[model samples]
Target chain A: MQVEGLSINLATIREQCGFAEAVDVCLKHGITAIAPWRDQVAAIGLDEAARIVHSNGLKLTGLCRGGFFPAADALGREKALDDNRRAIDEAAALGADCLVLVVGGLPDGSKDIDRARRMVEEGIAAVLPHARAAQVPLAIEPLHPMYAADRACVNTLGQALDICEALGAGVGVAIDVYHVWWDPDLAKQIARAGRMKAILAHHICDWLVPTKDMLTDRGMMGDGVIDLKGIRGMIEAAGFLGAQEVEIFSADNWWKRPAEEVIATCVERFRSCC
Target chain B: MQVEGLSINLATIREQCGFAEAVDVCLKHGITAIAPWRDQVAAIGLDEAARIVHSNGLKLTGLCRGGFFPAADALGREKALDDNRRAIDEAAALGADCLVLVVGGLPDGSKDIDRARRMVEEGIAAVLPHARAAQVPLAIEPLHPMYAADRACVNTLGQALDICEALGAGVGVAIDVYHVWWDPDLAKQIARAGRMKAILAHHICDWLVPTKDMLTDRGMMGDGVIDLKGIRGMIEAAGFLGAQEVEIFSADNWWKRPAEEVIATCVERFRSCC
Candidate 1:
């Protein structure tokens, strides 16, 4: 009864359940692979979280995020690198496939995106050695351009791949359909990601037409305008046969639903829609 | 004294005034150029609007849009083309430099952005003869990626330039800072636009950090994080010495202010910020 190629990023159910309960629900629905946020792992204690994973023989698709390297001062940037090192350590402990990084945006009161982007590259490069030592591949999740100012300056897969190519190994990109489905060069960049062997993860979610909230209005797989299946085909064609991780941030609808209903819906849609 | 190189897109004060009044306000503020929406032109009738433009010797930087090419059916597609032809006529009558095209998003129930983009290209090609004859350049304004689903599928300067290149001449692009500022490849594309001589219009506006509304809520110049002078420098260096058309659609803030105040603020910002 296990779903063959699906993973649930725990943020999809962050509002409805903690790390343990979210896993229980995913398991009940035959979804054995999961990606948990660092906070989620921390909440349950990393040791306990690891214990649960080992006991269930669960596959950790990825550890939910570590980036946000850009800051106003040198000290602040160093602090961010220190934090990333810790995140890599946690991902190493969890046996996660990769550590997803939502690389930070502009420092407070700054408009220099180029500088911020340079900072992101530098921060990633600084942590590359530690991440390599820990065997946690750093996955740079290029956020949507709307989030370019406040969230992640890395806004395109091509841009992320450029960083990966620049920094050398121990760095790849997390291809989230929500952030990149609008890209005209999506297929080309995706193929490039495959060529560079820089695609570390594949995240799935639909983009709502009248996306109500910029941050939390992500749609479930089948609900919105994204050609999820088309994107998945492109990813598969690009030589990534990894689990299609579901990462919806629907505050108004899916997040309001019960954890069981959410997982059930994810499973149903993963079959019928995604 | 007239604000030498600034043009007011009437949509900036759209909520505050109609065609005649908006023109009067701009004239009073010593702003000699304006870009009015098609509806605003129609409100006072094109003849009267043209009279005002001629009498005051005002320049039309560009007309406020004509695209929305993708439709659900062939009939709908034809209807869009017919409408675009009419928009060309309006731009010609108004003596606008270009007819800015928002270029439609996905048709009803269609998730294929590639097809929608094709439809946009086809739609433009279908209307090109009329536009060329009318001598009104078609300026494809690559909207913000956030509007890629509902507003414009052409979401990058490079993508717009590609369309322009493929479609041949009589078509260029409206390089709106709000949309293209987030592009990682912005400076390079702007230079490419310059090299191609495909830079038809230069629209100016800021991107508010916590952009409240997707359609409206555009920050005034100097209000948000967009590096205005930097982008302007790029465009200017690219050999585009055209007016910086101030196009803000702030629903809650600027839209609620007096037309005179908004025009004055635009002039002030044009000098100080842009």
Candidate 2:
């Protein structure tokens, strides 16, 4: 019953259960691998969270996030860098495989994406040493283009690779199907990431046709329009045999369901669709 | 005073007025160029709409759309091709510069984006001879990636240009800033588009920070995070001197405002921001 090469990013059941309870549900369903958000870890206190994770002998696929470097002023930018350093420390303590970073988008009242991108590069460079010292690899998760204004400006695999190349060894990419399934250059970029050995994580979810909400409303594995097997094939070809982390942020449907049902469904979908 | 080199895509005020009224407002504001949707033309009858345009010598920047090729079955695909041929004829009748194609996304119940993209290319190729005979160019509008699932699978300038190159002449690209702004390779691709003379239309709209709705939360030119002047400079540098067509789909905000105010703001933003 062990679901080989599969991990549940706890955000899928964040609304239904806390960190400890979500882990219990995952364990019940034979899912020993997981990725947890910073807030989720903080809620249970990092020490207790680490203790539970260690005692259960669970595989920590990745830590939820740490990036949003663009800011309007010097002080704001410095604050973001400081926060990312703390996240690096947390990832190290948890023994997570990598620290996923959703690089921030445009600053307030700013139309200059190029400048914001430059700020992102600078912020990452500033934190690289600390992340390396903590033995945590930084995974830049390029968001969908729709989130380019408010969520994350890094919106392409190639772009993320470019940053990885610039930042050198400590940085890599988190390839999420929800954000990148439509990319025409997906095959080429995955190959590039593989050549550079920059693919750190693989995230899975389907893109609903009538995506009712931009931030949420993500479909479960087999329910929508993503070629999960095809993307996984690409990732596997790229030499990443890591867990396919399920990270659905559904507000109306999945979030309202019981935590047990959600985990059960994830296990079923992982076996059947993914 | 006339806002030089500016065009209004009538969808900006589609909720407030019909073809004649929208035209009247545009003319009153000294705007000589406009792009009207097929529905707006059909609502007032194409003959009347054509008559109005001829009487006032209005410049039809580009027809408001014609593409959605992916279909569940052969019948649907054939119907889409037939409809595109009609759209080409209509664009020719209106003396529009080109028939803009929002090339359709994945067929219903399928997750094969590559197949959907092929359908789009074939659909365009099928209609090319007719478009050439009618003396109307086909402009493939690369919609934002956010629309890749249900609207259009062709979501990047490079992808659109690849289709153009493969299909040969009488085909080009419509460079909408709202769609292409987040592309890291935008400048390079715009330059590539220029060298190939593939730039047919330049649509302008701001990307709001907190985009409330995926399909309709488009912001006005100066109101969001897009660098209008910067993108315009790139397009102009790429040898596209056509009017910067303002197209916004703001259902909750701008659509609720008075038609005159919306047009006035468009003109103002067109002057200052773009």
Candidate 3:
């Protein structure tokens, strides 16, 4: 009873399970594809994690993640690049589809987002050679504008596409529903991403009204206002029928639930809502 | 000295004082321009509010606000239009430059934002005749993307401008720095807004990092990451020499302060930062 086209990003269950248990839950529920964060992989040991993923014949939709490109100084940026190179190596080992990037925002006490954006581009360019060499595609995840000051400065799919166009190759975009569902130009940009062949991953989570917390209050598929099926249809039309990776970061609600229950709910919601 | 080009949106001191006291405080500080919410005006009684403004020769930058078009049924929509018509009359009475529109979000149990946006446009179109007769312009204030679901579906200047272009004369936009400072196309859109002569109001408030509350925690002009002077430069270059209205919605901080202190601070900040 393999769910034909669904994937679970491990962050959806990060509080309840680690890398290995998450995979086990996904497998138990017929979800064979998973995306795991770097810390989770590191905690379980990359070699052991890779062995488990391979032995189970699991699809690693993406490795989450590697991009905090902006830094206050050149030395700090070099550190970030070195870490990203390590992440690429890990992605290569896991045979993950792509390395998802949450590109950094403003440096300490600086108001210059343009400079921060430039830094993100340059950081990605610096790592392009290594990522390409590792056969890993870099997927820039454009975060919502609310996170513009503290998190990813890359805040739109079109902006991400512009970056991808600037850098020759080995770069793409991860279309996350929570970050981009409200975009007026969503269909146009998703289509543009399709034409550019840059839609490396698709992530799902609803945007709850009265979104209680700015960062950790993501909703499950059907509980909020996002037109999940509609967006999935758009993505499918755009030529990427990849798994819709579920990534929820709900602190007060979903995170408190048992891992099994969470996975079960994800499966149910995916079938019924998403 | 009278601060040459500054306006006070009364919401900044909403928690501390009501309409008349707020106006007195503004006049005492030499800020003769103000934007008052309908509730504030109703509390003071519109006739008295109008008298105060007339006697003091105050400029009504805008009346805050009108537009909540999306409703669950036809009756609800008609009610919204009726309310918007009343708001138009109030703006006319106050000699306000425009009636700001915080266009409504999706209706209850409905995730159809396109329908909601269409409702907003239709609502505006329905009210345009009344607004024109009353001699009050309509200023569509494009809210931040975070408010797209509950507060406003119109989340970008470009989107608002598109509506204005479609609606034709007596319709424009209120460019709030807090709402639109993060836009990658902000400069270009502001320029476009200027080209169309659609820039009606320029609201100033910094976007604080770690914005504690999405609705109320806006920063002062010099406090946050928004390039206030730069944005002001853009607005001015776009031929909008109108007052830069101070509109901070700080629940725990600014609202708790005395009205005098807030007005004084606004005057000082408008000179130094904005």
- Cα RMSD (angstroms) for every candidate in the order listed: 0.9, 1.1, 1.0
The DockQ of predicted model 1 stands at: 0.82
* Model 1 accuracy (lDDT, Cα): 0.94
Q: Write the per-residue lDDT of candidate 1 for residues B1-274, one digit (tens) a residue.
A: 7889999999999998989899889988899999999999888899999999888899999997899999999999999999999999999998999999999899989999999999999999999999999999999999989999999999999999999999998999999999989899999999999999999889998999899888788998998999999999999999999999999999899999999889999999999998
lDDT, residue A39, candidate 3: 94
Collision count for each candidate, in order: 1, 0, 0
Runs of candidate 1 exceeding 4 Å displacement: none
Model 2: per-residue Cα lDDT at residue B268: 88
**Residue A266, model 3, lDDT:** 93
Residue B202 CA displacement from its true place in model 1, Å: 0.9
Displacement of residue B127 (Cα, Å) in model 1 is: 0.9
**Which regions of candidate 3 are displaced past 4 Å?**
none
Using TM-score, rank the candidates from best to worst: 1, 3, 2
The global Cα lDDT (0 to 1) of model 3 is 0.93
Give one digit per residue, the lDDT tens place, for model 3 in B11-87.
99999888989988998888889999999999989999999889999999999999998999999999999999999
Candidate 2 has an lDDT of 0.93
Q: Write the per-residue lDDT of candidate 2 for residues B210-271, one digit (tens) a residue.
A: 88898899999988878888988898899999999999999999999999999999998888
* Model 2: per-residue Cα lDDT at residue A78: 95
Q: Give candidate 2 regions above 4 Å deviation.
A: none
